[model samples]
Target: MADEVKLLGVVGSPFVCRIQIALKLKGIEYKFVQEDLANKSDLLLKYNPVHKKVPVFVHNEKPISESLVIIEYIDEVWKNNSIFPSDPYHRALARFWAKFIDDKIVTPSFKSVFTVDEKEREKSIAESTEALQILENELKEKFFGGKEFGFVDISAVFIAFWIPLFQDIIGLKLFTAEKFPNLYKWSQEFLNHPTVKEIMPPRDPLFSFFKGIHDKLHSSSK
Candidate 1:
């Protein structure tokens, strides 16, 4: 029987984009159900009762939550176009960087950019920059997982697409060719990938939406 795959995702969500990239890379045809985060759906609540979050991957009546986990699941189920490296050591390294991106880079960077307090924002920016520098060092080649785009590359999609929008919204620049040359080039390569380019949201709407959130955060904090 063919697998019935459906993805519940929110627009402009980096986490959701990870799964989208994975599905696209694996050539998996699935229905994308957009979720209104303002008012989550009953299906989202039912599938992901704990987090009630988007990017829930439903496969043949079973539900999988968490972006990374969903991505791994997709790769495992669809054997063609493997995302993880076949070598054990390289695969471990890929997993390590993916986790580091979530913990050290994405979390701190978001806090740094979105926080209303100046001191907290500065601290987070410094931490995020340090983390990014580490990633820049790791990308010694065209892609994080060597020549081909794989797990680590998919995991870091936020750096390519979303961070630019965040930079415009917050009026601060964290990523630049001069500052992080390797990552800047990698971002360009990642964004320009045929599948990624096809699925990316328009920049104007993304900027407006995040700008509204930025304004709300600042206003509420006042």
Candidate 2:
């Protein structure tokens, strides 16, 4: 019998989706335990003692934190379907892009939507566009990543999934069909995957719900 796996996540999180994608790819059976960020449960706090963040995967009895870490662990443990490249160099390259996004785009992308200040919005846009440009240049000749769906492709697909929802929040049109054709095509390909398409939140619900949350978080902070 397979080990019992439990995931602590909030559907609102793209971070949670990363692990969910990997687990589905590996055909793992697991129970999802939803966590409320505003009032975190004891399980989430216990599993993720340091960060106390969602998307924590408990495999058997061992707790794994961080989405990327959880995904990599899934890829390793369930080796039948691999997310990283076979070659060591290629695997390193994939990790490089993942790290780049974590460092460059993720935080600013979140801030871009929640921040009301013009300066903050401008900064987020500038940083995000620069990061996107790097991806464009690197992945130009690629379904998404260097002839096959690899780790970089997996990490990048989130940009497409969330960008439109984010545009609604920011009241802008930075990511569009015409603006980034390559990225647009990649987005369609990534989202069209049966597993991804099936599990992802619908645009109407995700955007409307997150918009309200964004407004609430910002308002309460003021």
* Best prediction by lDDT: 1
Give the 10-residue window scoring lowest on summed lDDT in candidate 2: 139-148
| TM-score of every candidate | 0.97, 0.92
Model 1: per-residue Cα lDDT over 38-104, one tens digit each: 8999999999999998889999989999999998888888999999998999888888999999998
How far residue 54's Cα lies from its native spot in candidate 1, in Å, is: 1.2
Question: How do the residues 1-222 of candidate 2 rate in per-residue lDDT, one tens digit apiece?
Answer: 679999999885788888777777778899999888999999888889999998899999899998888888888888987788788987788888998887777778877887767698789988987887777667665554565566777677568788778887867888777877787777787888886776676678888887997889778877
Once superposed on the true structure, which residue ranges of model 1 sit more than 4 Å away at CA?
Answer: none
What is the RMSD of candidate 2?
1.9
Candidate 1 clash pair list: none
Best by TM-score: 1
